[model samples]
Target: MTSSAPAPVAWAILGFCAVALVLRLLWLSGQVRSSERLVTYGLLLGTASGLLRERAVQDGLADLGMLSVGLTRQLSTVVMVLTFAPLCLLAISWSERWPARQAGISGLVWASAYASGIAMLVVGTHARSLELYIDRAEGWQTPVYFAFFSGWCGATGVLMTYTSIKELRAGDLRPIHRLTYLTILVVGAWALEEALSIFVSSVCAATGTGGGFVEFRFRANENNYIYLLAGGAMVAASGVVSELARRLRIDPASRAVRQLTPMWEDLIAACPEIPRPANPDIRMSSRRRVHRMTVEIRDALLVLGRYAEPVPDDMGGHGGEAVQIVRALRRKQSGAMPGQYLRLQASAPGRDVLDEARALSKITKHWNDARKCPEAIPSLDGDRAG
Candidate 1:
């Protein structure tokens, strides 16, 4: 069946899929061998192939003689089978801590199933409108064709749902990963529902009890495709947004690391016993590096506190603490006697480790000036003596 104008929902779904496909493509460009890439590949294949099943797209292709309606329907099923390959691989790679050999064996089994399903679908089903075939086609072949397709979908859905649930239960997932798995869970549930519906409809047709249910099932299946495609696209778009958020966080931490490096070096030099990992892991993320540096700086400050004099009432805040820290470093370096040990506090209290890094970054700026003229600040002991 063809319509001169497609439904408004169809256009909306198509537009959403197009935008999502573009974002996934952009994300894929930067990824290398990650789960995100596998998910993106699945979305790309599913979305692109799903367009073929749209009535408007099929009508257009038929008009141009590029593909008949029957051919488009068959091609959509084939592409769907192909789309699951990447998704299954993702599930296998994530859910199993298995060695490469075992993972490969599992992959091979899934590959064979997919290949067999597609072969059965193409060879058993005739080149006729799928809607009509499902509604009116009478034969053992018709039910068998639908059984294989629905069974494949059911298996895929079960696997995806199981993997998603397993991952979610592991806890401590990043926000992006949590969102991705939740999306998978939703899609898997929908797939299971769609598979069961298709299987029941096929059985009804084979048993001559279809009645008006066939038409409802056909329309329901079409709606299911729309939901599936739209859901996939939205998840891909969310991935892009998540990537941007991650960059925003890392970029500032990276800048803070650079800003605090000099102060960190000075503190480390004064407190040699402050445990610095001789060989820091180069692969640590910027946020982790910032936390590590903040902790080490705090440790060094505690040790240097032994040489620190009390801060004067006038020299209070972070600027004052920065000035006192410079003097403490000088006293330690010059072999001065260990005197008062005043606890250092930041001018602005931090809410978290990253905030603490930013607070220290501000202190480091003041420290640069204090180190240049440490003698200008009078010693508390000198004041007491006077």
Candidate 2:
């Protein structure tokens, strides 16, 4: 703002806006479609406009000529002017609890915002003429432009805070509480900062040394410090948003699920009766297939559990459940049905799919080898039905 120069905070705000844009794009990459996403798009555009304005002033575009300064002023007004649409979309989405009435209310807000934005754009051409500048808007221009800017940002901030709190209260798992609250607080803090800036500019206009209609300005260092802090807040929020999107994306290549493949293949080969999922999607997330395989494996083990011969009293718990299977198999009559008698005693594969699958593979190897031993066990028909 000093000598028509941009503050470092202006650059920081631009960075924050870029961070927000990246986060929104990442979130969208997961195929998330909603009004909130639309809001993100609007915010992205608004922030982009803010960035251009900052750069315009920073590069001393105005020093080139009066036409350049006018363009710079127009750019400043346009920055907030661009935010209304996305903020309104957010407001509409936030009011989902009362859809019938919410749409009407949101429409009104939207109309008012666009109307204000158009008016500001028309009059804002004279923004450079005002005595005092706030966020690059002059004294007379500041109030009109921020009236719209503050409304959009302020309303969205409140709604988002409420949404985050509601989600926190409803969620049962405690691990996510940190992310949820952090998102809410960071967003609220940044919104409050911008909203407060609007008010500060108004105060400066009324009470500063300008005597009601003279240009007022602040030191670049002081302004940059505040922008940097606000930008940091936004960057932190962007990180959280990025992580949340990543967590929510469908995992088409799950390492744990892939590990289960070797074990599952062996199980099905040994016991063809283990039902496979019908018409599985080749591109579906591996987690889904993992679920089906784990369930069938559990069922197959239960069937085998019935055929298990009594553990010899001499054996000491057979080195836990898995080793017991090997010992019992090695000692069973040639006719014993290992498929029916085998017990799945390890952790269910769904929770620790990779770990359990590897363990199962080891067990599978042992069972296959034991079946080949000289016991010459008879087939199911050769031995009496258990």
TM-score, each model?
0.66, 0.57
What's the C-alpha lDDT at position 288 in model 1? 82
Which 10-residue window in model 2 sums to the lowest lDDT? 213-222
Report every candidate's CA lDDT: 0.71, 0.52
Candidate 1 residue lDDT tens string, 1-386: 22213478767777877776677676556775557776777787777667777787888898998977776766676677677766666666664464455557556856766676567556545526345544346556566767766776777789889988988999877687899899789878977987888778877776778757866886665666766667667766776776665567546677788888999999988889898888999988777888999999989888877777656556666777787788777777777677566666545465667667878888888777777754425454432211
TM-score (C-alpha) between model 2 and the true structure: 0.57
Best by TM-score: 1
Best by lDDT: 1
Q: Which stretches of candidate 1 lie over 4 Å from their true place?
A: 1-9, 96-110, 127-131, 167-183, 242-386
Instruction: Estimate the lDDT of model 2.
Output: 0.52
The CA root-mean-square deviation of candidate 1, after full C-alpha superposition on the true structure, stands at 6.3
Scored by lDDT, model 1 comes in at 0.71
List of clashing residue pairs for candidate 2: 9-227, 131-214, 131-215, 304-340, 334-377, 334-378, 335-377, 335-378
Tell me the tens digit of each residue's lDDT in model 2 across 1-386: 22223556466566776776677666553544455455565656666555545545535765666445555545554555556565546545655564567657656765776687677666555545553244444345556656666666677667666666776677653466658566765676667565566556654554443433222223432244335435533643554465564366534325445544654554455455667766768866455666666676666555545455433344332123444443343333333544444443543344455445555544544444444543323234423233
